[model samples]
Target: MQSPAEDSTTHAPTRDCDVLVIGGGPAGSTASTFLARRGWRVAMLEKDAHPRFHIGESLLPMNLPILERMGALDKVAAIGVRKSGADFPADGGGYNVFRFERALDARCDHAFQVRRSDFDRVLFEHAAGEGVDARQQLRVVSVEPLACGGSLVSAIGPDGPCSWRARYVVDASGRDAFLGGKRRIKRRNTRHQSAALFSHFEGVERREGVDAGNVSIYRHAHGWIWMIPLPDGVTSVGAVCYPDYMKTRRGDSEGFLMRTLRTVPEVAQRMAAATRCADVHATGNYAYECTEMAGKGWVLVGDAYCFVDPMFSSGVFLGMHGAEQAAGMVDAALREPAREAALQQALRRHIDAGTDEFKWFIYRFTSPAMRHLFANPRNVLQVEDAVVAMLAGDVFDNPRVRRRLRVFRALYAVTSLAMLPRALRNGLRRRRQSRVDFSGETLQAEES
Candidate 1:
C-alpha cells in the first residue's frame, strides 16, 4: 500500500449526496453499504486509500451476519482466513484455547483475521459495488452545519478544495470522527489507559492442531502481547502496555515494540522464529468518547461515538453493530417525519450499549488477577461460555454476557479477598522482574 504522501494526485472535484460517510474503515463501509442498499445516494469519503495498512486484524463470529446483510459475506469469507478461536499463553507454561462455537453465544460460531489493508479494501469495494458513490484520498477539511438544519462539507481530495451538501450526515467516521471534532464532543476515557506498538510478520508460531487458526495472547510484565494469524502466512503481533510502562520507552516505535516483545518469553520466542514485514507502528492512550451520539440532523456510528481499547477486538464488532442501528435509524428518518426524533434517540441508546459492552472487558483485561486467571486453570463451563461470548463481541442482544458481566463484577469484588495472596505474590514477582520506573499509581478498574 502506498502512503498518503505518495498518492498526491487527487481526483477531479466532485459533489452531491443523500448521505456522506467519512472514513472508509469497517464502520464507514458497513454504514455506507447499508445506506446505499436502502436506495439512498450514499457517498463515502476516505482519507486513506483502500488496501491501506492498518492494525487490529482480528474478528468476532457475530460480525459475519452484518457482512451477510451487506451482501459481502461471500466476498469477506473469500478474503477472510478462518479464526476458530483465541488462545492465551501466560508467563507460566499454561495456555487456554477458546473456540467461540463452544460458547453459549451461538452467533459467533466462527470468525476470521484479515490484513486490515485487504479487509478495509474489500468492504470499501463492496460498498461501492453496492452502488454507493465513494472515493478514497478525499480528506474532510471542514464540516459546516447549515442554518436550514443541513450540513455543508468542504473537502480536500486528490485535487483541490471541494464542497458538498447533505440534508443529514452519518458520522461513520471511525476513530477520527471528523464531525465529532466540529461538534467539539470528543471526550477521553480514563479507565484502563494503554498504548500499543505493532507490526506484521511471517513464520510466527501458530498451533498446528485446532490452534493452527487462532490468536495468541501472551502475558508480560508491562502488559500483554497479541498474535493474530492472517490468511496469508504472515501473522500480526502487537504489544500493549500501560501508559506508565510506555513512558519508560525511548520514544521510538520500533525500539519500543521490539523491547516490549522481548519482555514476554512466549512472544519473544515466537517472534524470534518470525520476521517483521514493515516498519513498527505505535498508538497511544486508547480512549475517546463523544458527548452526544446523535443530533437534529445526524447520528454517530462506529468509533464516531466512542472507542474503547482493542483488547477484545471489539472495534470492528461495535462499529458494525452501530451501523446496524444507523441503517434502521437513517431509513426511518427518511421515511417518516415523526420517527426522525425517535430514530436519533435509538442511535444514542445503541451507542451507549456498544460503549458499555466493550468498556466492561477493556477494564477487566488490565486486571492482574484476570490476566492470571487466563494463565492458570480455572474452568466453570458457564464462566468460560460467558467470557467466550464477550470475546465473540456479541454484546448486542447477549443477555448471557450481560448477566455474567454482572456476576463477574460482583465476583471480582469478592475475589479481591481470595486472590489477595495470589495478586500480592504475582505483583512482587513482576516488580522484581521488570524495572519499576513509574510511580506506584494503580490503574483504574473500568473498561471504557
Candidate 2:
C-alpha cells in the first residue's frame, strides 16, 4: 500500500516501477493486482475516493471466472447481491423475462446486482492491501512518456501531489483518460448517439419469481429504461435516450427523467407511489471512441478505449476483459523490448474484438424492430438457444456466440429498415414543429 508520504511527494520518483497504472476502477484494480501477484512491482493511482458512486450495477454471467481468477470472488460474494437475470419490456406493450438457467452454460446461472460504489471500492481496497503500491484520491495531472525508456506521471491528491517514472504505464483510467487530452484521441460518436439519467430507490416495484431478482428493461416511446435490483433492496433505474430526445430536456433533468418514466405504462405503474432514493442523477452525450486504446508504453482499459450505449451491461465485462488480454502483453513488455511490436498488434486485435462484441447489440438495441423482436421472440430453430445465450452475456469463450451474432447481424440489417425510417420520420416532424411560424405569435406592436 502507498503511504501518506508517497501521496505528497512532488518530484518524480528516481526509482521506477514495473508498471504505473492510473485510475482505480475495476479494470485498473484488476490489472494492478494481477501484475503485482506475478512478482512485478505495480503502482496504481486513483483520482477518486473509494465508495464513490458509479453506474452499471448489472453483471454479466461471465464476470465470475475473472473475479475467481483474481482471487476476489469471496470478497465479491461477501457483499453479494442477487441478480437472477433480465426481463426485457418492449414499446409495443410486450416483453419476455429470460433467466440464466435458460443459457447453454448453466454453470453461470446467476450474477450479482451491486452498488457500483461499494463494488468498485472493494476491488481498489483489495488491490492496495495485496501489496500494489496503491493510492486513492490521486489524480494524474500529467503523463510524459520518457524519451529513453519510461513514462513520468504527475498526480494530485488529498495529501498534496506526487509523481513517478515507470518503465510501463497501464492506462486503466476508465473512459476519462487523463492522458487522452494530451493525445487528442477522444471524440464523440454522432451516428449512434445517446444520453442517460439514473437514480436509486428502495421501494421500486419488482416482479415475482426470477424476474424480481432480475434487471428489467421497459421500452417507452422515446427510449428505453433499465431497472436493476441491488443487494440492500435498492433498485437502480435509468433511461438512455436518443440525441434529439435528449435535446428537448434542456436543463430539466429531474422532470425529464420522471416524465419519460411515465411514458412507459409498466414502468409508470410500478413507480406510481414510489419515492426517489436521492436527487435524480443525469449524464449526457453518452458516446465516445478513442483512436488509440494501447501504445508502446501504455494501454487504455475499460471506458478509456471507447464507449457506446450501456444497454447490454458490457461496460464492466468488456473493461475487465480488456485488462485480462492486456495482461499477457504487459507481462512481456515489462522485460522484452523486442516483443513490443507483436504486443501492440495483439492489443489492437483484442480491442477490436471487444469493441465489435459491444457494438453488435448497441447498434440494434434501440431499433423498433429489435424492440418488436425481443417483445416477440422468434428465429429459425437452429439459432434460438444460441441467441438466448448471447443475450445472457455468454459470448466470451463460446464459439457459438460468433455464429449467433452473425445471424443477429443479418436480422438487424433487414428489420432495422422498418425501424430506422420511422425514427427519422419522427425527428423530421419534431424539427418542423420547432420551426413553425412562431413569428405569428409575436405582436405587431414592436414593428409599429
Best by lDDT: 1
Q: How do all models score by TM-score? A: 0.89, 0.89
lDDT for each residue of candidate 2 in 1-448, tens digit (9 for 90 to 100): 2332342345433346779998899989988888888888889988888888888887777778788888887888778677777788644565676777677545577778778898899888888877898888888888777788788778877766667777888888876865666799988876577779988877788888656778788765556799888776688889887655565563367776887788777888888767887668877768887887677788777788777777777788777777877776788887787888788787778667756766767776766677667777664643555666765666666776667767877876777776787868865765544322223232112110
Give the distance in Å from residue 44's predicted Cα in candidate 1 to where it truly belongs.
Answer: 0.7
Residue pairs in steric clash, candidate 2? 174-304, 175-303
lDDT of 1: 0.76
| Candidate 1 lowest-lDDT run of ten | 1-10
How many residue pairs collide in each prediction?
4, 2
Task: List ranges where model 1 is wrong by over 4 Å.
Answer: 1-14, 90-92, 376-381, 421-448
Task: State the TM-score for model 2.
Answer: 0.89
Residue 267 deviation, candidate 2, in Å? 0.5
What does the lDDT read for residue 102 in candidate 2? 72
